[model samples]
Target: MTNPRADRVRDVAKLAQRSARTRRGLFLAEGPQAVREALRLDARLADDGAPRLVAEVYASAACLERYPELDALARATGALRTATDDVLAAMADTVSPQGILAVCRQLDVTLAEVLSRGPRLVAVLCRVQDPGNAGTILRAADSAGADAVVFTEGSVDPYNPKTVRSTAGSLFHVPFVIGADPAELAQQLRGAGVGVLAADGYGPVDLDALQDESAARRLTVGPPVVGPLGDGTLGDRALGGGANGEAAPEGRSSGEGEAAPSYALEAPTAWLFGNEAQGLSDAELALADARVAVPLYGEAESLNVGTAATVCLYASARAQRRGQRTG
Candidate 1:
């Protein structure tokens, strides 16, 4: 492992290529920040009955000394190995290595598995091509307490190196799905009692309006029956996310209320954000229960998709958290 030209270094370096990543079913997480998160999550996810994501950790002596957590994790998992600085640099995609990197299996879960948790908030990146945008959105989703993120077909690969770097370890914090069908995913979410909202600059529904309405409705008595937004996609009369269609407060309900309080953003929600340049197609927008727009107050033309997603996801997260406490 000391030699930079070793076969292990070459193979690990090859992961920068998508083809190589796909062939090997593994991706490289460069730098200590990314690698540390992977190690932490590997054990945490396992506790939740999900497979461990981190398979191996290669680090320079400096990194292990600088971060004792890494040393402890390696001792526990038996996956840590010391490497020369040159070896780490060879395995990293960045010009300056962070003294460590991780080899982790691509962490993807089935759509059914994700929905079975009855997630309160979710983000769907539809046809977003930029790796940086995708990674930033993942970070935003994690920060907003989104349960999971979905990368629809034509969206950037969730495991891309640039995307991983931009995530700053949030990638390991939140679960994500790749290559999902936008239409099918929408239908599935609707079926699970989650409302699907599409993010569009020209969307008819104002995000602020939805928040105001949600706040105003917090004290209502009857559980709101969620229906289709006349988009001809989801059926009417469906209750928002809950166990067995009953109002479960969190993913698991404790019989807190007879019926769940429903708000536009309080209900189990999946937000669809389109490509950075073209935005969502007509059909893509139509798949949502409603199309929501973040109103721009400044003279700026439009917000970038990453920024828009952050605003939208946080709005939903705030509403959902408040609803949970109230319930």
Candidate 2:
């Protein structure tokens, strides 16, 4: 084993973390599965895992003086802990350090890259700041045969440990992108020829309403409806939200078809979900041509972010599947 006395505090590991932070493109992963995921990341962050033996490590000599076990761990592991307890706090994601962390690079992709050929489905994480919620949505996106997933500006980083774990290994199954600017995103989707849709928990139309009789359809979001495309023209477009904000553009389309024609949900589309605390912003919402929601029969005020998102995306997947069969 390497000797702690021979190692410096600013070794390769610390440098790697600094680089990642500087570039806004680095993450650290611990455990075998997380390491595997790091390797698979488009921006491969690390190939090896930092090992913390059954010893303690202190961030500083003062900390060591305060907590002798931390020093003892250093003696055991041969890795020098930094000089700041706060640094350790930030680095230590768990209540206790696992002694194993893998540094990784972030994969920043564009709209075109996200919507690569294969399927015509899209998952939009508008402002879902909960890392777990974000990751779970990605997992669902992969499971539902999504072509890609888009994360808006205010969303959490998908590489967060909590978020990554929530994915349940779905990170490798599909591609996801980040859209930092709503206006830029709108242009990109329009350029890519991908329809943009938003999820409204209290939307007027049912999600199933996006379908056409002939199997070709726009992306539908909302609850399941009785009739097909354009069947239920919502006169009561009352939206229940004061907790969110948005910056969508004028004349932006959310795939609202004119007049009820036999429509289907087989068209290429992207669906945007919102934050755990608050839903999508008002300005951002205007970008959507139409909105839909799940009809919760129970008296629950609203569903949790994960449950609601799953319902929205799965509804689209189901519509597309049926459309494909008919087509």
Candidate 3:
């Protein structure tokens, strides 16, 4: 494996392209961290009698000595191969592959499979174009304990080299569904008892206010009851009503007669984060039960999608955990 011009090197290098990756159903995971995670997942799946994820591993001798755990995990896959630094670089997407790389099978699951698992928190990326942003959001979702991450049809491919690198190995730790339709996905999430929320800069609902209400409910005298909108009297206030318990702000109310949709921060929720430039489309926002905006006290115009998502997901995670404890 010392020759960088070998056919095997070229084959592995081709995975950097989306077309090649799709054709082979394989992608390259470069660097010690990414490859180690891939091999670890492969080992876990294998232990569970599931299909293995790592198809092959190419590592330099120095890498194996530097990270003995990677060497052990790679050998456990029964697909480890020794290669020179030149060969490793030739087969990797990164300028410096960090002495190791692995070829892994795409691990995306179906939308039905994800819903069937009864996920409590999910992140939906709607037409997010940047690979780095998508990866960062996925990493945030993983850190926030989200059940899964969903990428809509127009979103950037999660298997892209830049995205895989941007994830920093979090890609292997989370379950994700690809190519979901926004409208249909929303309906499905609702059907599964999951509330759909859109992250919009101009949204009427204040995220902080929702958190405060959630905390108050949890600490109240009575046990918290969870159900659909209009099931209880918390609708108006939870949506966007003022502190005095009057009607919500103009254009923010549900209607004159009907109660506003209930969006308890503790309930099962799937958040929709839109593109870096355009944000969520009007149609996409309409798919959500409510649109929530991350408040800014400072002079910043808006928060990045990744940062906003971290805030929203962590909010849900905290509320959900508190609900579990208090219920």
lDDT of each: 0.77, 0.55, 0.83
- Give the per-residue lDDT digits (tens) of candidate 1, residues 91-163: 8888998898889999878888898998878999989999999999999999999999999999988888999
Task: Name the better of 1 and 3 by lDDT.
Answer: 3
Lowest summed lDDT window (length 10), candidate 1: 241-250
Which of candidates 2 and 3 is the stronger one according to lDDT? 3
Q: Sorted by lDDT, highest first, which candidate order results?
A: 3, 1, 2
- 1-327 in candidate 3: lDDT tens per residue? 999999999999999999999999999888888888898889899999999999999999999999999999999888999999899988988887799999999999999999999999999999888888899999999999999999999999999998998898999999999999999999999899898888876555567767887888887887555533433333333232222111233334422343444468898999999888777887997898776766665544457788888889999999999999888
Top-scoring candidate (TM-score): 3
Candidate 2: how large is its RMSD? 9.9
TM-score per candidate, chains pooled:
0.85, 0.64, 0.90
Query: Model 3: which residue pairs collide?
Result: none
Order of the predicted models by TM-score, top scorer first: 3, 1, 2
Count steric clashes of candidate 3.
0
The parts of candidate 3 lying over 4 Å away from their true place are 221-262
Q: What lDDT, from 0 to 1, does candidate 3 have? A: 0.83
Q: What's model 1's lDDT at 280?
A: 81
Candidate 1 overall lDDT versus native: 0.77
- Which model scores highest in lDDT? 3
